[model samples]
Target chain A: MAKEKSSTKPESPAESSGHGGGGKSGGEVNVFDHLELLSAMGRDFASSLDIEASLKRAIEHITNYVNAEGGALFMLDDEGETLRCHASVGPVEIIGLTLEADQGIVGRCVQSNASEFIRDVSKDKAFHGGVDEETGFTTRSILCAPMSVKDERIGAIELINKRGGDGLFADSDLHLLEAMSASAAMAIINARMAEALVEQERLARELELAAEIQRSLLPEPGGEDYPVVGVNHPARTVSGDFYDFFPLDDGRICFNLGDVSGKGMNAALLMAKTASLYRCLGKTVRTPGRLMARVNTEICETATRGMFVTLAGGIYDPKTGIIRLANAGHEPPLFHRPDGEFQDFPAEAPPVGITPILADGDEFPEIELHLDGGTLYIFTDGVTEGYLEDGSELEVEGFKTLIRDNAAQDTATRLDAVISLIKRGDTALRDDLTLLAIDDAKGHAARQAGESPEPVSVDIEAAAVEEELLLSLTVPSRADRLKTIRNAVTEAAKLCGLGKDPAHDVVLAVDEACQNIIRHAYGGSPNGKIKLKICRTEGELIILLRDFAETIDVSKVKPRELDDVKPGGLGTHFIREVMDETYFLDPPVDGGNLLRMIKRL
Target chain B: MNHEIKEDGGAVIVALEGDVDLQSSPDARKVLLECVGRKMPVLVDLSGVGYIDSSGVASLVESLQSARKTGSNLILVAVSEGARRVLELARLDKVFTICDTVEDGIAQVRP
Candidate 1:
């Protein structure tokens, strides 16, 4: 574009000057003098869009054509707020200084929206002195005009030290500068617009990639028997908070919701990694508590030194009607009871991946709820710390009130109302918000209320016999070993003539037992020893695995969901699922941990 | 399982040509998902397959698990001695309908 204009400019100006006819200027007395000169000046000014080259050409053309000694062109900055020296030629020493609309002779032209002609710089109060000192020259005259665009004064173009042999800058010099200023202003505006378009294209491409990654990381809505809903709304193109849910075996639903500390692409990228790690490890490990533990370790290993994630994850047992949940310094979960009571469980701890040695006994938090018909609502700080109109943060008390006010609405409507309130009350949410709600009403329907069954004693002898036959004698505790144990036990139950259903039970049971040893006893160190003994007893095949390690406090432990995707402990639920009877014991006085598994044969 | 998928006409011939063990099961599952994703009938030939573990069998079972919904069929063909020994040892021979050759596996496809 610049090339076409530059080429056209020279031809038009020569034609107007009648230079192509090779006629010399006829002694200042022509039939059409000002008309020819004005046409030639317009051609010279309209030639190029390259601000640098056009400014250079304009200054030279003004000096030679109008017979001016020096000139300067100041173009407006992109914001239209400041004027900067863009180009200059001859003896105008001050080339790069900025001039505000009320600062100097040039500024006065922009402010008054008119041109100025000064015969002597010493007579003007606005003549900034630094230029004369550096150039070792005295400014004799100044011709200044506003580079106005659509009646808006963008900047001022000034010509100095005119040379018409003895007179100061006349009306013709000002007229010539005004014409050049108009075209130069147009060129500057066009160049800035083009630059903005290029930058926007680059940003659009980056956003596309981020959206693609975010979509791929989200879990599908339906797969297992239970129904689930997951939503993410980033304040920008991407969010630093994420939520994911997938199915697990034994009619369990695994899910996690997390938030990274910062915002933008960096926070979004970290959120993606955190979500992926939970999904991968959830599929590999069955329990939520263990999943979070491992996810914490992995994040600590790869994340920025101080980076951490506030996460909450658990598995919902659709059959058992229980939710095994764990938290990593995240918001306390809000519970809405079917009877209209609301409670927010505050079993919070430090955020995951923040510390290597979390308080061993006290820091490990496990909270279980017999979520008969209650709703578990989890969210990021963007929800709780949402800004109120007065700039104060919305605390948990306000959120509880919101839930209480909207308790009668359906689950979908309730969630929508909550989001609306947050948006209305807090126009400026300082962080990203993520919310997840799950209800186990159907699971509650499967059971009769108030049915009390006496707890039966576990037949240890029978479980030990079952474990002996099914389990691989003593294998190192790796995920691979878990696979080996799952397969071997499944096959043994089938061989024992327990049929397909019972075989699945035995497989799930043995997996839990082996995992307990692997997680709590061995700690995935691959150096610990675990023994398996499988046998048959009284219409059931019994299995017992023992590890000569620190005794596990069976009473202090809560049953965890086997398929909880994000990390935490899920050992006890796997036990409940696979075995008709589960028993935990410690050797009389020694440090040996025993887990017995039994399935009716 | 080391999956080597080759297209033959409209069908895909996925050659399981190595030991299908615990470590290789995930890769096998991914290949099966890809085949189903493309809506192709897959004849998984186990003739060159040397060994099969429970995890490998689980992958094949998962293929059967999701194939119907994905509108695809997965069949096993040409089980070698080593692989057959392992599958029979794990009692999965009764679970999967096996064929003696790749042609028979393709013939066993219902639709």
Candidate 2:
């Protein structure tokens, strides 16, 4: 009962004045009535923080205080171009309606930022009859006032047809409405500001989660003996640029870098898709051009609107010192010769996802370079377009100069020099940055010589054979164990009277095969073990690798098109390229795979 | 890895030091992702870094993807030797914008 009275107390002023009868009384009594009304209205305004509910209560009070037949509160939209009727009373449902800010008396009050009183609405040129047409309400006189906070006009409130016999709205009525409108305007602004802050906080949390998922898709760095590296710096939480590298069975490294157009989640998703496609297809396809074509077609089929990928990739054969490259609308890669000359291999084909299919004959064109002992630098445009503090771009020429200056340095130092030159000023990057450096085998040897010596422990077990078993050993599926495994295999091959070239090929093939088992079959699990057995027959050398890991579908294990131009799946391609014959056996009942390869001596 | 974030204009500049490897990449990832969530341009300073492994590179890549989603930019400033080598070997130097200093990174973002 107390709650009900407290709520109704604010309405007592309107009931006591007999609906606009306050104007009939003299000045002192009218002033006293208004004072009571102002206090009551202030209590109602403080009752709720919700703008719509509080505005509705305020309008109801205004209509009763002024003895109006109808009243409406309009609010300005964000653009401040139009007024929307937010709350209404005593007439048709005009709530949720819109009007031009300059349309009627309410608009006039808003424009002038002052209260208005009309003795006869029919005589006023500013009176608009659209509401009457819609609501079937006749207006005799009207009172309107602008709603503002801190001198900024937000909207206005209007009351129509004073209810007394005179049917006229007085100046006092306009003044009361003006006071209430000011308070309402401040409440509305406060509510909206609060909502915006909450929304900002929600969005920030979602983006962080998205970034975590994207991070897991990238491969680990610094495992390859090929002296390769890649960096992707996003302007946001996730990046649309990606790069990947994997060793082929033939001691070569297949690597690729790509950029998806636009930024954010969509681009990141597309980038992951494109990278995976390249990796899956690159395994089957040995030719860089053919591999890129297949990846381009796949991207075109799946990419969303306004999305595409620019890719530059290649296969670097460490033995022959040859690099086969394919570019798809990506920046030209720089080839730095040992003699200090730079060669640019620019794009010859369009970016992927732009067309349904690449041009038939010239699809991603391939470029081949024989680097004796030089270094091949493949990169995206981030390097060439890096900005300095002066706002000048590090153009291709500047990139070349940096490369030339650092050409004599080791691969790591050379790459560091180039990046440092681009990062010489205090500025943020405008795009993702990526670079790949492939040095000749001699360079690999040079880098390796600086590394600390590893402890050598050989445990070779011999199985009965006609003459002798070359070598047999078992090691854990770990990257560090690879060197010891390779050395033992080479020594065994040498004892079998194999020439240096054949011995080298045997060593490479065995190393690549073990790498595949460790990386793919064992999934890099340190606990997984691989057994290597090499035996020389009367006319052939046979090698077998056995692993206890999940079995792969041998039938599905084929290299993608050579033009796929991505990384991964190249282990099989390498195995096929280096060995005379290779076979992947079905898993044994206990769950393990055996890979066998043969080379005619 | 250790990092500090500062606001410059409408962007956030993160200064990173120490080796960013498998062991420390998670920490780097957290700081970078937080900066990206602000939906403003980000600049990572790697001058104080001595080494960065694949996981470190992956963290930065993830940040780039997040920035793109939020319509912000992520840039690298003052790349160090180890970070540069890993980035170059993976061919990411061409994909990310490298700047010489934080001021340059801020200028690029604002411009």
Candidate 3:
């Protein structure tokens, strides 16, 4: 169409070239008119937000220049099975017309990426007359050009019935349409790319806001001392699994864990809804089964697209050592006996959001269990389905072994150890992991009567971030006050990479030294005061003990012989056995003694 | 310190709780001596002991000697972590008759 290429300056078609001075040749368009058409298409196809409207205008201008009665721009659907008219200008409104990609003239052009010129439509086998028969438009000649770039076939453009010429499309008309279709194809692809970028940014922002709402809906983490402990590690920025526990007025704790079906924003939104329903309805509805029914009723009315939530809920009384629980299609919660026995309770009803009411009369089935110095473990399938260190799935048995391995530790440590086991550093988590442990508080209390306080769980991440910590305390040298000193020392030792046996040994050594201050320093008098200062710097613990009593003979302090089989001097032996260095320091005041101890981490 | 004295299978079981140091070891010694006076068998459960000092160990040693004089068995059941370490420091673990559980302690005493 353009023998004269695009120039630096804009020029009128007649002045831009003189090729058409001989006035039009047989069945070909005027060179000046063709130049005008090409220039117009170039200017019109750029910078358009409404792609369909712009294409409609471009097709209208092309039909006029080609002197055709009508033209339609057909585009292939996503699946490429059919062609639909995206833009059309004709005597009949075939704008939204559709045809199978293998059945019509336009379809053939799109499939083959070639242009077609039908001089007479009556004899053309590729032409379908369905639109003509339905719209009462007369059959005539047709021109179809493939709208493609390289090998990609976007669609095809069709024009019919040349308007004042011999009522047929010519070679020049095919050339003009093919050139324009290529430009249109490129414009459509660019416009689609721009649209997709915009849509992606919008969805990202929406997902971020929804994730924030989900985090806000979550509850605070339970500490080691709390009998009920829960932990969650999300596979993605948002999770479909959630758990919560809160104390009730009647000295009982209510807890629940749930997993919503599906993934992405839809699943996350449903999870938030189900979690809120339980937190609100779990308070007044004492019976776990009745609470589940109310939650199910609310979910059934609102949850769409066949989404559902599997959940388990229970109320535990610390005084009575009993729990009343209800399960709804969740993984069976495991009850581990103190005797190393495991019993599983399976779900008896379907998950919520399937129906409004339960099939078994009114509520989900509930179980009453007594925790006799044992613990109940509730977790999602993510833990079992997680990959182990050897790359095999941590089936139910593997997960139970993780629990049993750390069962000798307290409840919080058991959960941490299990989480650290299945946690992967080289690959993303296959699913979200959520677990909860309900301890038998009353049973343990009856056995642990005047025992010292339990140690709190260490925050390993925080310990890594902080390299130094100082613990200072001053208390009377009394036997009852020794436990407080032991707890503080244990935490410091754990932070310095000394835990389990090594940490216990450090605590015992300190306890023995403090006992000497009460017995020997004060000479069995309760009137003396004691001070302790512990500091960890660069992975080394330095302990200082200050006593306000008569100074002892340092050289004479010794452990009794093993053959003696006595007890009073074992304190001195324990201190020498555990600490890397132990010596007496000069007292800061005149009337006291300072003992220095150091343990290399 | 607090303790519970129960007779199971002809063995006097004395379960001690809390820290047994200089201040509380005297009470533990009195209880152990009373159980030994029964002269059948004595099982001291150290499972509930949090922090037992040298004086507490001395009380156990005195009770064991008294128990031997009467020809009655003196056993330790469920010894706690802290108590076990203290016993091992002076090779007392080799000297004492220790069992893993109360059932084992009762079995050994009866047999």
Candidate 4:
């Protein structure tokens, strides 16, 4: 291939009319005739916004116009530091090749930003023989031009081995190739610009979607009966603490405020899962204690144990003026009374999903508050535990005072005052602060004034539906029969809801209730058969379960206190939360345990 | 919106049955592009349409791009009350010549 270089260098201009611009001296064309042809070529090349196709077409033009054997175009790498081959017309194998500065004729054009006409390759010290060796073709005379836009040299184009010719590549050939390279350079620049614009647009779309997912995870502000005020201020685009609320049957509203262990996407995901789990159980579970127990067991089974969630949930019964609440290892909730005094509800048990199970005889404290004309404030640690300018944590007591002082005003004013107090001596909230305030005064007033409105009944029974597995049983009306059925339903539902076991948690809760009634209430009494009714909703499973046991205990049962740590006698605790409703009704002839269990589907 | 067109040996027709405002313009555009890109002379039926907006006009223009690409034609039929007001507001009533009835629109597209 190197020996053919000497044969292509044409020694005389007289025999090379077709090789250069000298053939255009006939004077039949206009002054800008060459410019017009070049402009037309530029327009044709630049019209296409496609990078790969534009480069390929430019390479073809370089080979045909310059009368060379083949040509290759090399561009700067993404970082714009190294020259990588972009297009080649003649040699298929050498297309998309790479060359470094100071390497070959292509490198010299890129480094010097000048055109080079080499008539003989073996005599030129800068010539590299790799292309010749790969193509097995003669590298005779060569015309190389710098591919630059303005003063910036992006790459170089090299036309190798002039076809049907001998002698050095003329000056006019260099001029024509140089003009072609200018347009090629502009095409390369335009393509790169378009690619960058496309990349930026894609990133913006992804960010918008991420923002949407984050917004969807948050609970809606306020509710139908409960005028709730929810505020979540994330330190970044997303935060770890999440709060959610969903309606419950029998005029109860189930809501939870939770704090995940960390922040960012992982914590956001965990927050979503935790909120969903709490919402699911809140719909199924009847009371706070039972809800915490079911949630604790499920979280322990599925969630990372070390990374637990501190959640406080309550079912507000506007009809009875009673709020049944159970807390799992979270900040103590603050209650601001009409008398301008602050009382903190204690979170007597560890956070749910961390412990394996509620121990027998362990007291699960359930707080039954008769909400009067006052406000209930639920917040994350970000509000009180935040550092002040003096580097002091506000603590629970300080937050309580703040709420008590501000509760007399409108809800918005009260919230603003509370936040202002927290940020009094600080510039910004150091962590994400979440505050939820619900006004109970209006409902309380309506009830106290002897104008009783109908309770906001969200019937979960309407949504109870089951598809995968069904458990149906009819046992005799014996005291033991009720206990056995309760135990079976509760166990089934819990295992089913827990991700790993795949057994339904609602079914298991029902089973536990049956077993408790059988062992304690009937005590081997002679009675007819009992019935357990289980159904599923679109998002929950409802158990219209009933059992006949004459001695079913209704009143003297001690509700599980949160401080007790034993496990065996938690049947009542589980029943209260796992089943949406549990009522001991008197039979048409005799009293019996009439329990209803609802589990999220 | 109603569309009818006759080009070469084929015909195309489009029919709309609801408000063709900004809210429903995306659906209108998708359906119109389908008719034009198929190289069928087109007819658009706007007998039941209650409204149209500038967004609807833009979608119709997009159909023109596809019609030109496939070498077909598009014609509108039975302009409604609210739709005609929008087309008049945009001065597009002059741009797109209208046919009074579905039969007239179809005849305009017949070879």
Among these predictions, the greatest TM-score belongs to 2
Weakest ten-residue segment in model 4 chain A by summed lDDT: A559-568
TM-score of each: 0.53, 0.57, 0.51, 0.52
Pairs in clash, predicted candidate 3: none
Best-first order by TM-score: 2, 1, 4, 3
lDDT minimum window of 10 residues, candidate 2 chain A = A455-464
Question: Could you give candidate 2's per-residue lDDT for residues A254-356 as a string of tens digits?
Answer: 8898888888888888988988898888776767788888887787777787899888988876645678888888888888776778888888888888986
| Interface RMSD (Å), every candidate | 9.8, 11.0, 6.1, 30.2
Better of 2 and 3 by lDDT: 3
- Model 1 Cα lDDT, one tens digit per residue, A49-95: 45577666666665555556778877666565566787787765456
Q: What tens digits encode model 4's per-residue C-alpha lDDT throughout A180-249?
A: 7888888778877888899989877775576578678777766444556677776555677877766664
lDDT, candidate 2, at A510? 78
Candidate 3: C-alpha RMSD to true structure equals 26.0
Number of clashing pairs per prediction, in order: 25, 81, 0, 105
Q: In model 3, what is the error at residue B5, expressed in angstroms?
A: 72
Q: What is candidate 3's lDDT per residue for A280-394, written digit by digit as tens?
A: 9887677788889889999999889689999999888775577888999999999998788899999998998898868887788899998877899999998989887888888
Please give me the DockQ of candidate 4 compared with the native complex: 0.01
